[model samples]
Target chain A: MAGFFAFLGDVGRALWGAWTFDTSMAQWFGSHPDALAISATVAVLAGASTLLGNSVVLFLNRVKGWRFALSLLLNGLGFVLLYLTQAVIVIAVGQLATGRTVAWETVVEAVMLATAPLVFGFFELVPYLGPGIAKLLQAWGVAALLVIVQVVYSTSWWQAVWITGIAWGVMQLVSWALAKPLAALGAWFWRLISGKPVLLRPQDVLSGHQFMPVEFDFQLEPGEAGR
Target chain B: MIVSLLALLVVVVLLFLAVGPLEALGWWRAEGADEAVTTLAEIRAAHESVPEPVPYSHYVVYLSGIGAIDGTSIPEEEQPLIEHLRGHLPGFAVLNDVFPYAPDNRGLTAARPMARMWSWIEKARFANPEALVAMLVNARNAIQLFVCADRRYGPTYNIGTAQAILHSLFRAGYQLGSDVPVTLVGWSGGGQIALGASWYLGRAGIPLTVVSLGGMLSDDYGIDELQHLWHFRGSNDGLEKLGGVLFAGRWPGAVGSPWSRGLKEGRISVYELGPMQHNVTRHYFDTKTFAPDGRSYLEVSAEAIEAVLLGTEPKVIPVEK
Candidate 1:
């Protein structure tokens, strides 16, 4: 339990360090032999936070039992994969923009560390104000990424901004291009795990068809009309 | 000390926020409609004893405000209002046994993990004159109300609430698919519960009308599904106005929202009750406070509700500025 708290403290410090563009954060990540493992842990925390925050999907779909557990695990894995994809995109963009080589591990570490803001993603569970909070967290994550990039890559703020912007744009384009296939893959995986076809649309969830048909005895006996 | 207090307040707020979603999600785990059967059975037995037959002309399900702790308990101040409503509205069976806070119609003091703690809170609330402990009850129920209005949790929570309501209606001898109108009279948070349940109730072919008494309602529910909504707000009820301000969907600018559409289509009506406060003394249900016409506030509110139920224009009582 103490180790867990210490790790939590480390995560918090790393996030704060990245946000302030502290050189020590970049040095800490570079010197650590378990940098990749630590980055993966951060990515997983972000993934889990997101799943818990927007768990309406699980509830709406009525996913339950071992299937629910599987969905959470798979979704978390999906988030980690997405983060890894972002890290790779950032590294590619950084290398091209700077014309200087940086360690791939360092770039991945920075990307994952930047996502530390999203650990508060559970705030998305809040009603009405949740979406606004989620948006603010996303903006914070982007800002953190810019700062982390500046610190890690030894780039000027403007260069970091350009790299982050290009990377984000590339990620968006890649996501848009692969959106259909990715969604299909997700649905297929969901079916394999849950043994049910996923209800993809919010309308489908709200359609009231998922509920059991309640049988009401509307038939009134004679002389029961106006009692 | 001030910083510590501020930190504690923040923690409390966050905890309050977390509790709603957690409770709503818990329903998914306990798939069975786990109602407080004892309470439902008692209510059902009471309804059975009524001399009236299978269907009354109308069924008014009264959802109490945040002060409600259980299905069986009605706040003392509001009891007279219910009695007044029953006395005036002939052919209407007023069912107030359904607890609006829990989606399963389970009361806080019902047999559950938190029952003991809730019971202690209830005791402390009454034992203490300050009644600060009562705020816990209000805050807890208020969170459930938000869950009912929330887009993510609303559908799940509302479905369960609708099911529980359907059970209560059946027990009350309400004929499903009957042309008889079912009016949900929700006070404060109860208003949102009524609106939430209307979606499923309407789908079941029940003609639904919602009567909100200083209700903190959101525009998330199926307003189009409601036959009509009569929202009564006391002039001094700033808390009631918070619904309109807090929910962006309630804003006039949200032209696509159900509430805006309901307003445009004349399915929703807002009425101003004369200078009544939202709660406690001099509230809508306060029997001691009388208008210039010599009718108590409870009488005036009940009469207003009766008018809406009867499809007549409610006479506005004159009040002192």
Candidate 2:
């Protein structure tokens, strides 16, 4: 009952905020006219970007399973790489200075911006290269694949490489975050569907043991030894 | 556990429904609207009283706040104050056009066919102006009466209703004369409108003199070119603190009292009135800063209008206490 009230309180606050938002905003805009349009636009874009990025992580987790850890590592590394890309130094000493200090969000943004073009190009150039390139020369097949993938997707060159690296990173890190939660949910759902007498516990499943273990009958052996 | 969770969710939803929507609606409705409408009707009636009207010395242009329409939503007690300005300000003309000077209300309605038509016209009035006497009265009404009742604060606290008001006045100026002066008397949110108008108009090579009462003018007013600015504060009012924030944030390097901060060197004037509440017209009039003793905001602002337009020192009359 207490938890239910807490949930109700949260909902009420959110709704009230939304409802009052317009009038309160209108009044604010009335005072600070110049900043209204720009601020609203920035806020909207930020929210949309965050939501889209989270969805992509969920989608990739379903496909790669445990390999999602690679996605997480790559995502983290991509951020670090982008941060390093900003400061080009003599003798490449800045590379050593770059560490985990770079935020994951910034890396995600870089990957999103960079990978957007590659995804667009793959669908566009693949069909044209398939038949036309085959007739031109079977020996140049490897070259043709490179041309379609690299030429169209790799337009900006360095930035594209950086972005693709980040995209690769996002895929891996998201897989890592989702892996444990997804597995737990999966077990819960399986127990619900199969009507098994087992508790929906991921730890027990991983350990290969029953949640409620039974005692062994070693008492009879002790009495026989005494006789 | 499942039942508890579900029950908890239901209760949470019910509480939200009970409070959230209602709070939103209450704040939205708190905007003091009828005052503008009442004031407009009174002006219309006052205009009817003139047997043979003279071409106004300047246009008494009033801008409404965010949520309500000016002239149309003014309260009854305040009607005479605006009417006196409409009837008395020498060379003043009353515009029949409802510029939808308020953006939210700038839409098609039975009474307002030209709701936002002023936006286009304001552009045309860049060079011409007979003169403009504007009242930044709407914002005060909305904030002090409407938003204040809800006790909610947000970014909206920073917005000013002056931009739209200025745009309309600029258009009106274009229709009148190129070298005309604009006198503004703004209260609360209307004060912001006045500040923005003066800033924009001053930059355009037109002269603007604004006298604000308990308004929200911050140094942020982009009025480096304004000829003159006057600021007034009711000592006891709560809005002074917030308005100062805008002044500090927007106008980083301004000097002088709050009123004179954006004015040219030696052009700014500051007036500190005795401690009073919002809508203290009587106190303002008795202080001899306003035209008629114990008059409404519209009448008092109009008196200041005559001062700016005629370019003379205001006459002082002792109130018979």
Candidate 3:
């Protein structure tokens, strides 16, 4: 009973962290209800795609490289578009830091296994610490990645940590370099489809607008402004 | 020893060809349900819909029995009855050909074989549909059925059958409870599936009607979820009674078969056929006793369903052996 309660407490604290984990992620997710709905749909499709992709790899043993590529492409569907873009960059950076020419499968498998602990990301649904728990899980995930790296590469602990840390740094820098243009592109497309200028001055919207109107001429519903 | 084993493999292959795939594989568990696809299957329209010749509005999604249901061509044995029923009810009917132990689209068989070749061969059409091969070559009449190619009959996976049916119905444009109402019709073990699907649909508060024709009923909470249940059982159907006797469901009290209580409560209608026997619909002549009578349980049950769909007074069959 005590052990059970301890486990519960651990989960509770972890969830508390997740609730407060990443406010920016939450803000980004919450800012657009339409995007959130689309993400949920993508999550379901991603799950289906992963199952199909993995099943194909496991069952159909012939032409492995093509099958592996197909599996990766299928998994990318679940990447939540830009939602997981940062996560990939982070993992890629960790991989580079390891400085080992490990098989892609080994790294992919290790990363996949390490992320199992983040199943606690379920806590991300909790109001208070959802984001914190998620963010903490990312750190936990990194530590796990380091252990995997050390084992797979047969390296010293310090080397593993250094590899992971530098790799993450590299990834973060690269993602930072790329995120702006992608976000701008996504935002521009969003405005085009929604017919609403977002994050753009009216004159700039007009000047650059090959597609969308350069006007924010509508009033927000009183109850809808906060959302 | 190698030559003997090679000969044995040949014999096994020949046996599979003779008895059909289900018995050959003894395998019921399969992956890849094609969860989203509802194949439309074959449909029996009462008359011409383009000229508005008939006032056909309702849909009955047909779930086949055990190993009998397959992904290949729709069984033609069912055509005579559906044709007869469509004329009266103008009720459009489609076969839900989701097989649990049938062959897959890839032509790959299950890795395991649950039934012995001799045992399966002797009964012919007793359990699974015997006309599987003959039915395979039967021409499709442009109607669609949501096919779940890898569905096997055990309870562990039957829910997938139900879920697939639910999605198929939704895709077919039948609103949950209203507008175009839905009725689930299952034969033999398929009855359990209809009831199980009813449970899921009921929990969602969707109005449903489940019609089980000699379906193997289990004690489940879904029975209470259905708006109405029409059970057609022959007195000679030993398997239908097997659920109650083996599982201890049909007891004197309401512990086993909810039929007694549900019958009294007026939510369930039981049609007890005396001369009729199990497997009499598709395999009518396969059994010695019911085959001589030359009556198709498919026709009888279809009429009973027609009554339910038409909202007319139901004709009652007395319980007799």
Best by the DockQ measure: 1
True contacts kept of each: 0.18, 0.00, 0.00
Best by the lDDT measure: 1
lDDT of 3 by residue, B112-199 (tens): 2433432333244445555453232211100011011111112213334455665566555544324345678776655766775564
Give lDDT tens digits, candidate 1, residues B200-226.
677656778999999998995557689
- What are the per-residue Cα lDDT tens digits for candidate 2 across A1-227? 99667544543332232222222332332234333233333223323332322222222112134333443444445433432342222012212223223333332222222221121121111111212222322223222222222222323445334433443355457657877876666556445644443222323312321121111221122312112
In candidate 1, position A148 carries an lDDT of 83
For model 1, residues A1-227, the per-residue Cα lDDT tens digits are 99778776776666566555576667777777666767667767777887888676676566677877887887787677777898898888888888888888788887888887787788778765677778988888888889888877788989999999988788779878987788788788887876767654434433423332112232234333323
User: What interface RMSD does candidate 3 have?
Assistant: 22.6
**lDDT at B175, model 3:** 43
DockQ of each: 0.27, 0.01, 0.01
Could you tell me the C-alpha RMSD of candidate 3 in Å? 19.5
Q: Write the per-residue lDDT of candidate 2 for residues B1-321, one digit (tens) a residue.
A: 897699668545433322322222222223312222332343234333432322334554543332233435432333444565666665665332332223222322224445354333333333332112112223223333322111121101111122344345534543222344566655555556555444333433334566565566554333344566565565555665566663443354544433344444656565544343454344332333333455443444446545654665543333333
Model 2 captures what fraction of native contacts?
0.00
- lDDT values, one for every candidate: 0.76, 0.37, 0.46
DockQ measured for candidate 3: 0.01
Question: Residue pairs in steric clash, candidate 1?
Answer: none
In the order shown, the candidates' Cα RMSDs to the true structure are 5.4, 29.2, 19.5
